[model samples]
Target: MPKNVKPVYYGDYLQLDKLLDSQQPHSKQYGPEAHDEMLFIIVHQVYELWFKQVLHELRAIYKEFCAEQLDDRALQLVAHRLRRVLTIQDLMNDQVGVIETMTPQEFLEFRDYLVPASGFQSIQFKELEIILGLTRDTRIAFDQQSFYNRLSEEHRVYLEELETHPSLFDCVDQWLARMPFLQFDDFSFWDVYQQAVQNSLDRDEEIIRQNAADDGQLETELASLQVNRDNFSALFDNERYKSLQEDNRVRLSQRAMLSALFITQYREEPAFHLAHQVITSLAEMDEKLTIWRYKHAMMVQRMLGTKIGTGGSSGHDYLRRTTEQNRVFKDFFAMATYLLPKSALPELPSAVRQALGFYFRHDD
Candidate 1:
C-alpha cells in the first residue's frame, strides 16, 4: 500500500524516441513536405496529445456531476481542462499564422504528396468533439484507421457513464429549485440557463431600481458601473459581473443536460453535441462555428478551388451546406442578434475572413 511506489526510468527517452521518429514524408519534396512540413505535423500531433489530456479532464468532470458532487475539485478540474483546451486551440490558430508564412508554392511542392491524407481526418479531434457533445455528424464515420478505431472505444466508455447519470443540468435543477425564472424541462436548458443568468440580471436590475428609489450612493455606484462583455448587461459591477460569468458552466451544464441528445448506432445519439444553447451562445464568441464549415469550405475554395477533400467527401462545395449547423445553438445566435445594433447585425457573418487558404501563383 505504499504511495508513489512506481518504477522509474533514467534519461532513457524510450517512448519519446519512438514518437519523435514516427513522422515520415510521402515524397522527396524536402522544402514543402519535410522541411517546414515536419514542423506542421509535429504541431498537430502534439496538439492531439494535449487534446487527449483535455478529454480525460472532461470525462472526470462529467463523472463528478453524475455522482451528485459539484465540489470545488470538480470545478477546478473543469476550469483547468477548459483552459488547456483553449490554450491548445489558441496554439492551433497561431500555427495557421506560421503555415501562412510558407509561400503557397512552397506548400504546393509537398501538397501533392499528402495525397489522401488530411488533418480533418484526425480521430483524436473527433473524439474530443464527441466528448464535448458532438455526436451528430458523420464526419467521424470515415472508417480507415485501425489506431483511431481503438481510441473510439475508450471514448464510448466515458460517454456511457455520462448517459446513465443525472448530468450537470439535472444537478443544477436540484441546486436551484423554486427559482421563479428558472423553470426546468419544459422551458429548455438554454432557457433555464438563460433564466439563471437573468436572475442575476434581475437582481442587478432590482438593485438599480431600489437605489433610484432610495437616492443612495451604493445604488448609484451599481447603476453607473461599466457594461461591456461578450454576454449580458456588462455594466462593470466588478463583483457581480465576475460572479455571473463564473458559475456559467453550471448553467451551461444544465443547458447541456436539458437538451441532451441521445447518440445511438443508427440515428445514433449521445449528449456530446452539447445542449445546443452553447453553440448558439458561442456565436457571440464566433458566428463562424455555425459557419466554420463554410470557412473550411472557403479554404477549399481557395486552396484546391473545387477539388475534392482527401477523404473523398463532396469537398468545399459540400461544406457550404453545413455552414448552417448547430440546431440547438441557433437560438443563442438569434438571442444575440437581438442585442446587435441592428445595422451591424446584417453584415455580421461576413465581417471576418480567414486569411489562410489553399493556393499560390501557378508561377511559384
Candidate 2:
C-alpha cells in the first residue's frame, strides 16, 4: 500500500461534516420540529449508505459473471461478496424495528410535511432492484405507473437506460445454461435420472394408496403427485418448460435450471463445491431481500394502517405485493420440488465423476 503524503484525519477522511449536516428534516420547516422526525431521517440515511455499499459489491459480482470464463477463484469471490450483501440486508431488516419505535400518532406529527415524497423516490434502491432483474413489466400495476414517474427526470432517464442492459439474473442464466456437464458423450444423465424420478414417484403412489384413510384422501394425494410428475417431466421437455416460463412459474431457462439442479445434487463433487456455494448464496440473497420487504411492509402497516404513503402508494398493500411478487433466483428454491434424496439419486459414472474434478472440462 502507498503511504499517504500526510496523516489522514478521521473526520476529514470520512467527511463527517457533510454526512452529519445532510439530515435536515422537513418537519423543522413546518410549525414546530417533531422529535421522531430526526430518528426517521437518520435511519433512512444510514439505509442509503448501506444500499451504496451493497451496490458496490453487486456491481463487482455482476462484472465477474459477465466474463466469458468464470474460474473457481472468480466464483469464490462472487460468493464471498454475496455473503457481505446478505449481512447488510440482515441489518436493513433489523433497522425497520428501530423506525417502528415511533408510534403512528408520533409519525402523524411530521408525516404531512413530507407529502409527495416517498420511498419510491429512492433511486439507489430502484437501481438495486433493476440490476437484480426487476423489470417494469414485472412490477405491480401501481409500481409500473408511478415508480419512475415519482423520480426526478434525470433519475427516471438514468433508470430507463439501465433497464436496457442484461441484469445479473440474465448473466447468471447464460452462465448456467452454458454448462457442458448436462450431456457426456453417449451417456445421457437426465435419461437415467428420469427413470430414478419415475421410480420414486411410483413408490410414493404405492405408499399413498396403502395409507390413505379414504378414497377421497387417496384421490387428492394422487392428484398432487401427478402435478409433481408433470413438473419433473417439464425439466427435460423444452416446450413444456417454455410454457412454465410463459406462466411465470419459473424464471430460469430450462438448461440453466437443469444445470443448477445438477450442481446442487452433486455438490459434494470437487468441481461443483464452489458452484453450489454460488447458487446457495444467490438463493439466500433472494430470501433475505424478501424478508426485508415483508418486515418493511409490516412496519408500514404499523405506522400508517390503511392510509396512503407520503409517496402516494397504497402504503402497506403495495409493499406486501412486492414482497410476494418481486423475486430473483426463486428457481433455486423451487428446484427443491424436483430433488431426490441422496439414496434415490442415480450414481454418476466413474468417467462422469472424474470430469467433475477441480479442473472443469467443457467437452464438445
Candidate 3:
C-alpha cells in the first residue's frame, strides 16, 4: 500500500462538514423551525446513503451473473453480498420506527413546505428497483407513467438507458436456465419427480376423504386438491406453463424453475450446497425488501392517514400496492409449494450422485 501523502483527518475523510450542514429545513424559512423536520430530513438522507450501498452490491452481483459461467467461488460471493443487502434492508426497516417517533400533528407542521417532492422521486431507490428487474410494465400504474415524469431530465434518461440492459433477475434466470444437470444422458429427473408428486397427491386425497366432516367439506377439499393437481401438471406442460407466464402467475422460465427445484431438492450434496445458498439468499433479499416496503407504508399511514403524498401519490394506499406487487424473486418462495419430503424424493442414480458430490471412487 502507498503511504498517505498527508495524514487524513476523520471528519475530512468522511466530508462531515457538508454532511452536517445538509439538514437545512424549509420550516426555518417561514417561522420558528419545526423540530421534527430535521429528523425527517436526516432519516431520509441516511436511507439514500444505504440505498447507494445496496445498489453497489447489486451491481457487483449482476456482473457475476453476466459471466458465461459462475464457479462456486463466484456463487459464494453473490450469496455473501446478498446477505449483506438483507442486513441493510433490516436496518432500513427498523429506521421506520425512528421516524415514527414524530406524531401526525408534528409531521403536518412542515409537510406543507415540501410540495412537489415525494419518496417517488428518490432516484437511487428507483434505480435499485430497476436493477433488480422492476420493468416499467410490471410497475403499478402510477409508477409506470408518473414516476419517470417526476424525475429530472438527466435522471430520467439515465434510468431509461439502464432499463435496456439485462437486470439481475434476467441474468439469474438465464444462469439457472442453462444449468446442465437437468439432462444427464438418458436420466430424466422430472419424470421421477412427476411420479413422486402424483403419489404424494394421492396420499393427500385419501387423507382428506377420510378426515372431512361432511359432504360439503369433502367437496371443498377435493376442489382445492384438484387445483394443486392442475398446477403440478402445468409444471411439465410447455404450453400450459407459457400461459401461466403470460398471466404473470409465474416468472421463472420452465427450465430455470426445474433447475431451481433440482438444486433445492438436492441441496445437501456438495456441488449443490453453494448454489442453494445463492438461491436462498436471493429469496431472502426479496422478502426483506417486502418487509421494508410494508413498514414504510405503515409509517406513511401513521404520519398522513388518508392524505395524499407530497408528490401526488395516494400515500399509504399507493405504498401498500407496491409492498404487495413489486416482487422480483417471488417464484423462489412459491417453489416451496412444490417441494416433497426428503424421504419421498427419488433417490439419485449413483453416477449422478457422484457427479453432484466432491469425491468419486477410484478403481485400483
Candidate 1 residues 162-223, lDDT tens each? 44555333443342231221232333333333444555555656676766656586555555
How many clashes in each structure?
Answer: 20, 0, 0
Q: Which regions in candidate 1 have their CA more than 4 angstroms from the true location?
A: 1-14, 29-36, 137-302, 317-364
> Which lDDT value does model 3 have at 2?
86
- lDDT minimum window of 10 residues, candidate 2: 355-364
Off by over 4 Å in 3: 3-5, 357-364
Rank order by TM-score, top first? 2, 3, 1
* TM-scores vs. true structure, each candidate: 0.49, 0.97, 0.96
Better of 1 and 3 by TM-score: 3
Q: Cα lDDT of all candidates, in order? A: 0.43, 0.90, 0.90
Instruction: Identify the runs in model 2 with alpha carbons over 4 angstroms from their true place.
Output: 358-364
RMSD of each: 17.9, 1.8, 3.0
Q: What TM-score, to 2 decimals, does candidate 1 have?
A: 0.49
Clash count in backbone of candidate 3? 0
